[model samples]
Target: MLTVSEKFTAFRIHKDDNNKISSGFEQLSLEQLTAGEVVIKVAYSDINYKDALAATGKGRILRTYPLVGGIDLSGVVIRSEDPRFQSGDKVLVCGAQLSELYDGGYSEFARVKADSVVNLPQGISLRDAMALGTAGYTAALAIQRMEDNGQVPERGPIVVTGATGGVGSFAINMLSNIGYEVIAFTGKTEQAPYLQALGASKLLNRHDIEIGTKPLENAQWGGAIDNVGGETLAWLTRTTHVWGNIASIGLAGGIKLESTVMPFILRGVSLLGINSVEMPLSVRAQGWKRLASDLKPSKLALIAPTTIKFADLPQAFDAYVEGRVTGRTVVEIDASLD
Candidate 1:
């Protein structure tokens, strides 16, 4: 068992009284972390756009100051007050408000709420869990929700917007694995080969396409897994076929939805809002189960090709915030834990 007195390195974010945000590696003991029922010796963590925002102050991500700055982690339980988990069990925590409401995973150790923790599903390593992280988990959740809402291959080809992004990449691979013809809608047409390798059958170049002004344009897609919001999402609403489900996951393009009620009333289209945070434990468990199984991206390596040491984490956020990163980047805290 790890002792509470032992100090470990953590990438911590702090907001000053002047509201200037700064973050760096600092030594901390277990007693200094937020209240939690489970203690984990973290094996791996991963970068998400939210983590970049929190760490760099590019966007406001944390509700409180001076917390560790990773949003996702996978590790082994060294101690647990929760009856559901025991020592030495491998676990993962994603989208449970890490780095937002509670202290996060950018550390050698993590103290997390029991409800936020999940047993690492079979068939994935600790490294694999963080590689998937919240991005992969959210993609899986969007796909699952779409399927539950009657989305099927027969409905039509699934169009994934923000095609070069982490969620978009995973959605493309998972959708294709299950027999759906996947179309990638992206601004980065130069990355056609990368997207195609992830099972995208066609690439819709966002730059060249004309987004028509009609309330309902020609129905082109059976369904959609949208990561870019704003006009791109508006176009999706206008173009998706009857009874097709559009899983709205991100607001990268813009948050304002400028669309008429005609699509919902005339086409019976469903726009399912996909929020990974604050999900029910059962929902989180079921999502992970599927992620370890059918929804697991076959091109996992291609989707998350980079792994950085924990020491390299401070320098990594700038790429993510600048929108220069493609796919996921896993941070290795302790490879031996895998």
Candidate 2:
């Protein structure tokens, strides 16, 4: 146990009889935190859908209870015994069992295993990393796989479903920055200019790409970054161009996949599963480095979240789950006004 005798607070979820959900902020001793090689003064933690799920108990995102509920965090190392990190160094962590197998980052401080923490590379601030958060990391993983599989910007417009959401918005901006003519797909017609501002050359309504009764539809998209699963995935698989790829990042729409193998066999379309959590630390570092360099958004300053005090997180988190959040939402825990 690495006890530094520091006092802090965190929002924790604890279940009562009948498994009813209740969560609120609680004061914690340094020793109450889970054991880890490094202890950080948490600087930034953004609200993600998974975090909302864990907080609300709407989904089984957290396999454990009585847990702190943040899946990604960026901050400065305050105490460390690991050779790879030392006091005052900045870093960020995403996925890596936070709010799952261990206590997490919705606190004024955190203790994280050194094995899963990635030292933030040059060119990205700790704040920027948390603003990107798990959603952006998942987006980066999907785009990296697409490029690896020979999908190119010149092939055609890359379609990104769920364009108004975090992963979709980040991927759209990143793809457009790399010169891909991006097609943004969304249910909200009001977000057209917003998506276009992120470099989407076109907008497609969700209903336009609804799961058709047919199996194989016209091959339109050269490649895709799909965050919505179920029928949206099926449509993307069947309708993507020959030899193109679709990176499946979420089951937000659903888990059921009802597509045939014709897209895989005839057109040679490929589906790559991207699990940001449980990724090797080396690979996670590489993804973060790439995000810092190429995929980092040019307009992150404009497109990034509006900051809120730690006290406001519960209502904001509830708003997120109720489908009210548009862009990012960062909690200012132990943050300086500067």
Candidate 3:
């Protein structure tokens, strides 16, 4: 077994009196971390919206203060007490209380429960897995749930809101790859070309999607993968086809939904809530397996995730909070591993 580091660099968040929050890299010992069965030498971790929120204190992402802040990690096991995983085995972890109830993936090394981990699927690189991260996995889960509700490419265009973010981008690529015409909605009109390149057949300015007084309208979309909830999701609910599925993922816009039951009661629209954070391991594994196969985008390089070193995360977190970054951003935690 590899000797655990006496001290490791981790980006930590601190909340002080008067509710001000500050974050920076700090040295932490192994004993400071929460207990788990597997110890991983983290090769990479990615910045999700929630991570950004936690790091910047913009949202209620953490239940505790002075915590390491990253929700997604990909790495190789350096030490394992569990038989299911051994030293040198590659794995990935997302959600499952990381960055919330537990110290998370921003550190050079992370000790996590083996049950909360998934063996890295064969044929996917550590970098590539981090590229997908939690965003891509959530996108896959959203699509799978929609498909389970009898959604099909033959139905018509699937509308994706918040189309410039990671989940929306991945949803577009995956839906298009599966032969569904994708209609992407975004406020950043400058990203039209980028969205089109990712297989969005049509692009709607965010302003174009307004929640009208009509309880239901002429259905314009067969289904929807929504990242920006609230008004955008409300609009999608009013516009989706009969028996259509609306996979609700993120709440980038706002949390409250102000809509009537007309869409569900009248048109039989199904609003599928996607909670990637607490999903069972079986579903999480299925999502990752599909992410490696049919849902894996050929244009990941085009997505061009902005990669940064672990130390640069404080600035990266600010960028994410300001909505200045696009696609995904993965942090290279251990240069020697890759």
Each prediction's Cα lDDT score? 0.94, 0.85, 0.88
Residue pairs with backbone atoms closer than 3 Å in model 1 (clashes): none
Deviating ranges (above 4 Å) for candidate 2: 1-5
Identify the leading candidate in terms of TM-score: 1
Tens digit per residue, CA lDDT, model 3, 74-134 = 8889888899898988899987789887889999889898889999997788888899888
- Using lDDT as the measure, the top candidate is 1
The sequence of per-residue lDDT tens digits that candidate 1 reaches over residues 42-137 is: 999999999999999989999987899899999999999999999999999999999998999999999999999999999999999988999899
Model 3, C-alpha of 160: deviation from truth (Å): 0.2
Candidate order by lDDT, decreasing, is: 1, 3, 2
Q: RMSD in angstroms, candidate 3?
A: 1.5
lDDT, model 3: 0.88
What clash count goes with each model?
0, 0, 0
Winner on TM-score between 1 and 3 is 1
After superposition, the stretches of candidate 1 with alpha carbons farther than 4 Å from their true spots are 1-5
